[model samples]
Target: MSGGCAVTLDDLTVALRALRLLAVDFPHLPAPDVDVSPVFPEWLRLSLHDTSCESLSAFEQWRTALRIAPEAVDSRTQSGGRTRVLKAEGQFAGAVIVLTAYADEPAADRAPAGQAGGVR
Candidate 1:
């Protein structure tokens, strides 16, 4: 494999591992598969069919896109002062996408408060 392809594969592996961990934390949700392909302009593709129709869906889509195009590192500032960093895999001019998946905060944290009847 080319150097760029190697980087892409590494990125995919990292993202997939992350996703698997996220799945353990959030067992109710289905984690998307990370796909890396040179056919689509050296971009990686992340995809999930069943998920919430709100911001979580959007994040899933973005995460998939970022994983595939791991070279485009971007930061997304979410609510509750949470920040997500999407990192790319290869160098500029020969970068490739790396797709990944993560469970949303709401899905991950089963209980926001330590006691019963706490706010979500």
Candidate 2:
């Protein structure tokens, strides 16, 4: 739906597959934990942006939603890690997706360690 040109799910899928290939070949990409979109090497990010940019917002929403329902997540018996489903109900067409991304720190957004009462 960009500039009156409809971008479809299939187009996004192809772009993702290419990005996956790049990730497999490239190493040490920054975790996709920056704000909403996963951080990647700039070149890779630009490449993905060029590919069906219409759906990026939908992807972010799904990622955030999964994080919300922690209890519903399945962690494969692992400690401190649980997998969740992305319903894709709103914008991603009829795809029920499970996203695989770097896990967030147990308290990444909380107060720094060893500090109390707003004092260092």
Candidate 3:
């Protein structure tokens, strides 16, 4: 909340337009299951290559360069791994959601190979 572009009218407008303009190349299959909670945040972290959720907005912005959110949801596909997409600018985090066909499995709860589920 203290870092990155403050959520403002201009910023929100800019954010939404960016989202609408992106071409994420989602799979063609019907989006199986979408969960906007835990899934979304994890997606942002992975896409942005960040260990902490603190830098998510920057991740979102970075995604803009690559093209990428404020929502923390889950999307599950039949074979494609679960992919997370961010919903930025409060409105998006709560409003718009995009879906693609390809999906694997939800890696949200998967622990490191040798670590226990709750170890981290």
TM-score between candidate 1 and the true structure: 0.26
Top lDDT prediction, candidate number: 1
Q: Which regions of candidate 3 are displaced past 4 Å? A: 1-6, 23-114, 117-120
TM-scores of the candidates in the order shown? 0.26, 0.22, 0.21
lDDT, candidate 3, 1-120, per-residue tens? 225645434434433443443334433222223333332322211233223443344444443443333243333222122332333222333333343222222477444455443211
Task: Arrange candidates by TM-score, descending.
Answer: 1, 2, 3
Instruction: For each candidate in the order shown, give its overall lDDT on alpha carbons.
Output: 0.41, 0.32, 0.33
Best-fitting candidate, scored by TM-score: 1
Candidate 3 accuracy as lDDT:
0.33
lDDT of 1 by residue, 1-120 (tens): 335534455544443454454456545544545564434434444443322334345444554533434335443323342323233343222444343323234344333334332222
lDDT, candidate 2, 21-102, per-residue tens: 5357433433332211222211122211212322344345434543435344332211232211122211122222333332
The local lDDT score (0 to 100) that residue 54 gets in candidate 2 is 28
List per-candidate RMSD values in Å: 13.2, 16.0, 13.3
